[model samples]
Target: MTADDRRVARYAAAAIALSVAEAALPSPLPGIKPGLANIIVLVVLARHGWRDAAWVSLLRVLAGSLAIGQFLAPGFFLALAGAVCSLAVLALAQALPVRWFGPVTASVLAAFAHIGGQILLARAWLVPHDGVFYLLPLFATAALVFGTINGLIAARLLALPQGKATS
Candidate 1:
């Protein structure tokens, strides 16, 4: 494999591991998660670029779903949807000035988009009921909390000397 391929794989592996670990945690709410793996994506975005970060995020969703035995399940669809939304937002956010926008801002925007996509998908495919919208407040709140935390962590990690290591 090429060097870039190896690098992407390593990042994907790390993200998948974090995803699995997050899966094991007991969440107070069904759809709420800390999304710790996203920190890797944000870091990759800042250090490398958006394309590399997209690879990492997409691979994480695929490999993580397979590892967690959630492949082709509703959970997998939700995850895929969220990743798609997050990546899209990140891509758009990339156009902003780097000095004014950073990992924390990107993370927050992506997190909200991720949750919004999941809710929309769930309402259309999984629940098919309007009542699912009622859960928006809870999910939105969780997204804000976790997104900010993950963003801050990414920002802090980006500040560290070792954090800049690509390998």
Candidate 2:
């Protein structure tokens, strides 16, 4: 593969791996996930640019749901919407002169947007009982914790030389 294609493939693999890992992780709150795949998304965005990262995120979510047997579930649609919204946030962040915010800020914004979309989708489709509202705080908490960790990891990875050997 060409260099860019190889890079994208690598990102996609990472995202898919993380997505499956995240899905396999036990969650106290149903439909809530740590968004571990986002670490790869942030890394791709920082290194390859937003377009490539967005594609990775999209593919990851789609393939992830299929793997987890939730391909056509409301949760899958929520995830897809969340991924799209998160990418939009990332793209907008890239345009701003907010270098000081760094990947951490972008991650937080993207994470929040991702959860927000899921919340809206859940409220619209399955949780007509308004119980979905109760999960917002949990989602927010998970997003902040996971987003910060993912952001820091991405930041550190970006600092290393390209294709550096990892233990």
Candidate 3:
């Protein structure tokens, strides 16, 4: 495989591993995940680019879902939607000046977009009620807190010695 392909594969594997680990963690709410996998995506966006980040994110959702036996299920669709929305937002966020739009900002944007996407999908497929909106406050708070924490971790990893590969 090509170098970029290899990088994408490695990052995708790491992200999938994180997804599996987070899946094992207990959550008060069904959909509330720490999104540890996103840290790798953010780092890839920095070191690689949007395209590479997109590949890694998509692969993680697909492969991670299969690994967790969520493939082709509602949960898998939710994850796919979230990843697509997050990647779209991150692409736009990247247009902003890098001086201000770094890991944390990108991550926050991505997180909100991810949650928004999930809400939309859940409303359409799973819940089919306006009442689903009621959970936004709690989910958004989780998004903000977890997004910031993951962003901080990504920033630290990016700051490490170049010889040490986050991949």
Candidate 4:
């Protein structure tokens, strides 16, 4: 396989792994996750570009769901929706000047979009009540906290020494 293909595979695997790992963690609320897999997506976005990032992100949702036995279920749809929304936000985020906008900004925006997508989906089909909106502040806070942390992690990875090995 080509180098980019290999890189995409590697990144996607890592993202899927993270997704599965996080799935085992206990969350006080349903549908609230740190989205740790997004760190890989941000890294791919920087090391490669948005397209590769999309592949990694989508693969994580698809493969991770299957691995967790949630494929084609409600959880799968929620994850797919979140990933799609986050990717759309990231696409537009790339247009911003790099000097001002970087991984952290992109992460925060994408995180918010991720949770926003989930909330909207939950409101529309799952819950179908205005009551779902009541959780906005909580989810938003989680997004901010997790997004910033994941972005910082990606930034650190981007700064690592290239002498380790060739891509």
Instruction: Assess each prediction's global lDDT (C-alpha) against the native.
Output: 0.93, 0.83, 0.93, 0.91
**Cα lDDT of model 3 by residue, 73-110, tens digit:** 99999999999999999999989998876799999889
Clashes of each: 0, 0, 0, 0
Tell me the tens digit of each residue's lDDT in model 4 across 5-74.
8889988999999999999999999877889999999988987899999999999999999999999999
**Candidate 1 global lDDT:** 0.93
Query: Could you tell me every candidate's TM-score relative to the true structure?
Result: 0.96, 0.90, 0.96, 0.95
Misplaced by over 4 Å in model 4 are: 163-166
C-alpha RMSD values across all candidates: 1.3, 2.5, 1.3, 1.3
Alpha-carbon RMSD, candidate 4? 1.3
Candidate 1 stretches greater than 4 Å from native = 162-167
Tell me the lDDT of candidate 3.
Answer: 0.93
By summed lDDT, the worst window of 10 consecutive residues in model 2 runs over 158-167
On TM-score, the candidate that comes out on top is 3
Off by over 4 Å in 2: 1-3, 164-167
Candidate 2 residue 64 Cα shift, in angstroms, is 1.6
- For candidate 4, list the clashing residue pairs, or say none: none
What lDDT, from 0 to 1, does candidate 2 have?
0.83
Ranked by TM-score, the better of candidates 1 and 2 is 1
